[model samples]
Target: MSSTRLLVIQPSRTNPPAALAEWLRDAGAELDVVLASEQPLPASLDGYAGVVCLGGEMSALDDLRHPWLASVRKLLAEAVTRNVPTLAICLGAQLLAAATGGVVRPMEDGPEVGGRLVAKRDSVGTDPLFADLPWTPDVLQFHSDEISSLPAGAQLLASSPRCQNQAFLVGTCAYGVQFHIETTTETVLEWAAADPEAAERAPRGGFTRDGLDQLHEDLAETWKPFAQRFVRLAEEGPRPNGSLGRNLPLV
Candidate 1:
């Protein structure tokens, strides 16, 4: 529908879903951005056609410092329960995991930063968001915490050696990605500049701004279509009863 609208929850000032928003717009979905860092989330997922939660520097557990995160998590849980299409990235992924009875913790090996490849699992063949991806797709990793366990009934769609829960599907419409598909060279540079120590320890080897540019180009080749697919799913909207459908238990 030409009038379709999606809600984008930006949790951190530095970490916005830059390219993802662009791709969604190109796919014909209008966006209503909410800076959760500054404003309150609506009480429910009543109006939006879809929800997209972006990454941040904070741990998904740091609700004391960022009190709004709890509300965001509640909204995500609602999105899953209502069968609303959702895309959760990085910290957003961890939040989705935690909200849905999954486990999120600091990685034993520390952060996974910069460009890396995650292998697709066989289950991806049936996942609407991940079905057409390459066997190993390049993605940006910038978080220290990992999803050690998935929610019960969550379908694993992809993994990397360091992170078993790289990507997964919860219920029928909610998706979570441990790695980022929305980063740009400038975004990576800003993040790297903000945390030089982590930048030095990036697992894909320390990334240069130029290297990130190339990697982002590679990422765009694959993820743009994936984003468009998500938009198409949003266009489908919720069921006639305004429920996400009776697919799977969200939690």
Candidate 2:
């Protein structure tokens, strides 16, 4: 519990959100990060305290198009089997679902964008990875598809009104949050500027840089509590019976 090293799996060609490195430092994690463009898939998980999967443009369903996703799927499975605390963001969450006995698809619930409000699922009251502090919290978002279903035996934790499986617990006490609480204002701008129409067309408030900055300052206290709690879980390891079954396994 004292010396769990955190592994950052970044699938994006662009740099990871600034919040990631900052949060790792704040968590006192011995950090090691890798990008998809630089390294191949299924990198070693041994000695990694927890696995942090970051988002990217790739879809989790197209293993044939992006072979690296296949490797990530395998890696997530092994990490879960070993009871590692894995937090998958966006595409990573999709990968985690596809890795376990779940499906990843184009979301029918519609795209969730900007600073959206989310209620903590009943399961969040005493979650080991997420402690209670607020009835609802708003977070940044980016993604077209989401995990349509959870792995067998997983616990539902949090949900934005739009997405039912916004957060989940996959044995090992491992957790995944679909919304990007790890985003900063600058990162928000960087992502939003990618598409011109996104500034006002987003379903949620995450578009304007000014709006995001204000919210980031406001949410600092709220999200930090969850991030800190996540660090503890990463160090101490997930609760027993957190791994998925081999028979009811991810296809």
RMSD of each: 2.7, 2.4
Residue 229 error for model 2, in Å? 1.6
lDDT of each: 0.86, 0.73
lDDT of 1: 0.86
Candidate 1 lDDT trough over 10 residues, lowest sum: 241-250
**TM-score (all chains, Cα) for each model:** 0.93, 0.89
lDDT per residue for candidate 2 within 68-141, as digits (tens), equals 77777777776777777888888888888878877777767556677777777776766666657576877766
lDDT of 1 by residue, 37-76 (tens): 8988888888899999999999897988988898888889
Clashes of each: 2, 6
